[model samples]
Target: MKTRQALFLVWAACTALANHGAWAQNNPVLLADVKAPRVLMVEEATGTVLLSRKPDEPFAPGSIAKMMTVETVLDALSRSEISLDTTYPVTEFAWRTGGAPSRTTTMFAALRSNITVRDLLSGVIVQNANDGCIVLAEGLAGSEPAFVTRMNERANTLGLSGSRFGNSTGLPPAESSMTAIDMVRLARHMRTAYPQVLPLYTQADFEWNRIRQRNKNPLLGTIAGVDGFAAGFAEGAGFSLMATAMRGDTRLYLAMSGLASEKERQDEAARLLEWGFNGFTSLTVYGAGNVVGQAVVYGGAAEKVALAPREDVRVYAPTGDLGRLSAQVVYRGPIRAPINRDQEVGRIRIMIGDAVLQEAPVYTSEAVGEGGLASRAKDAVWSLLFSWL
Candidate 1:
């Protein structure tokens, strides 16, 4: 494998935007004021992270893990393994552990009573019902432990490397943890993959067994564009929140943990959400279909193949010019011949200083077939020379 540094230029227009008086200066000071030990805020459109601190450090997710639980169920629904109308019984275990007996957040469903998947989702989303999570876990996988296995598997499939589920309900005494970055990834995936089901998070309240509870997420309705996601707390991890907000064409996902109080959690989340929306502007790094870079094609008719992003490669940059911006096209090479058009070959990583702010996949723009014996021989000689160097 070899690494090549390709040319990456920032358009003058981006610099002009940064200079414009309308935009606020990049505020590292404000970000520093955030009290959470782990925090991340990302632009949904370009996946550009506006602010991050200890994003990869794992912490007890508390009720925030419910988002993953919801994602697992949504995955099952998409696979047709279960329907919204499917029902599960609330066993004594569920009632004792998460319902009225446990004195935690719950939908208060009667023991041995069966509830529909639709209602369970409502309970989980709107009420953060632990019993609903247990019932759904048991119903879907015949036991909570079995369902937990599915949850961890789903997390892996989703590329959430910093998360693990010990139980469906995220209750204490059951080990479950997640990173700030993983929470953002999960929230983004849920919103993107399950748009139809996202409205469940906006539901203000849910009623079951004649007991009603308002949505536990504090940001909803209070923040200008806050809509869905969850808030959580653990004894050692303190408070945590995973939330998404949309204002017009832009949407942002945020995750923060290790706050001192619930008030701090809500306040820090709101502050970051506002900052994410107002503190950055979009900059197109590469237009749609524009060749971003090139990758060596081994034994191909052509020595190299052009690579481009299928969509416009964009990043949300700070309004102020506080840091140097650069990009690199990264790929393992030389890619073998017979590469098809639009085949993914590499990634474009956009960075500020040494920190990667965003990354997007790049693909071959055209097919490259195997070359003649002479071409192969020439490439082999060049490869040998480079190896010696």
Candidate 2:
């Protein structure tokens, strides 16, 4: 088994290199020409940005802020703070602030109507219903302002430095802003950490109060493999989209803000996703549990310990390869003994040219016990001999 695994690893490495050579002959267009003022496309497995434009510049996110609403509610559900079946009273604040008379987009929840968390999620995510968000906010956190505070806390926890939430619906008060990159990160985290809610994003239409309205996501059903997320538009924010799609094993995320119109938003998002799928192919350099390399150990029974990735090590190769990709095994060296098997000790940094795309944590493959006197002396001798050489 060990021999076959070793042979497979060697063969995989060689095959990847040969494919790199073949790909170099074809020059693929860079995404600099993509016209969206702010856009980002990230390959999920490797955290590789196939394309990005002003990703960090904050702008009005419109309803894309609802993704955070979906995420936060799902988290509350998981913690048993709420349940799919739990119902909340539709407060006047929810109705008057975001409901029909306000002339804002809504799920049409009647004043003081009791609604389930599940139904509200569908309304907010699928319909981008502002009333649904306010209701959930008021129900879960007592008020929209308190819920907005939680959203910011969650955003900060997610490392979304360029994002702030002014309301559950991402309405503008000048304080709510998010960069394309931050939106992408938020979407990716939600998809990965809370996959159950993703299907709600794809629902074609939601019905409430006997009024059925179709989902506003332009890419839904139109774009192959496209799953739904959220879209937003405010008078000042223009149109924004945070959408994701999966084909085969690869999932790609896109976030764009300030699109001139709905048509432009759809066109730019589709073009970007198409470019991503066509512009990059991924390479699995190390499978989970496969020993990537070895690390020197001190005071251990073994002089060196096998290092394996905590998860699979995948790297994105541009559709038409520039050259063979490279990576480096990085860790604090000469790991001291009493190391347990499966202990995290280091990481594998996947690289494209001088840039690092992904870092997969590496771990010890077996326990390293404290060495006996004889073994210690032998290691000491080996170190001395290697130093002399």
Whose TM-score is greatest here? Answer: 1
Candidate no. 2 TM-score: 0.79
Those runs of model 1 whose alpha carbons end farther than 4 Å from true positions after fitting are: 1-31, 291-310, 322-349, 360-389
List the lowest-lDDT window of 10 residues for candidate 2: 1-10
TM-scores for every predicted model: 0.81, 0.79
How well is each residue in 1-389 modelled by candidate 1, as lDDT tens digits? 34232333322222323344554576543666878899988888887877789999999999999888899999999999999999999999999998999999999989999999999999999999999999999999999999999999999999999999999888899999999999998988888899999888888887888888788889989998889899999989999998899998899888899999998888888778877877777777667788867888888999889988888778887766434566678887788788999999888877767777778888999999999999988877777766653
Which tens-of-lDDT digit does each residue in 1-389 have in candidate 2? 01011111111122234545665343454556666778888888788877778999988887787888888898899899989999988888888877887687889899988999999988887777889999999899988889989988988988999988888987655368889998888888887789787778888898999999998788999888898687888676688888889999988988887778999888888777876777777887677888767887766888888888877777776756536466677776567677899998777776667777677788899999989988777666665655433
lDDT of each: 0.85, 0.79
TM-score of 1: 0.81
Report the CA-based lDDT of candidate 1 relative to the real structure: 0.85
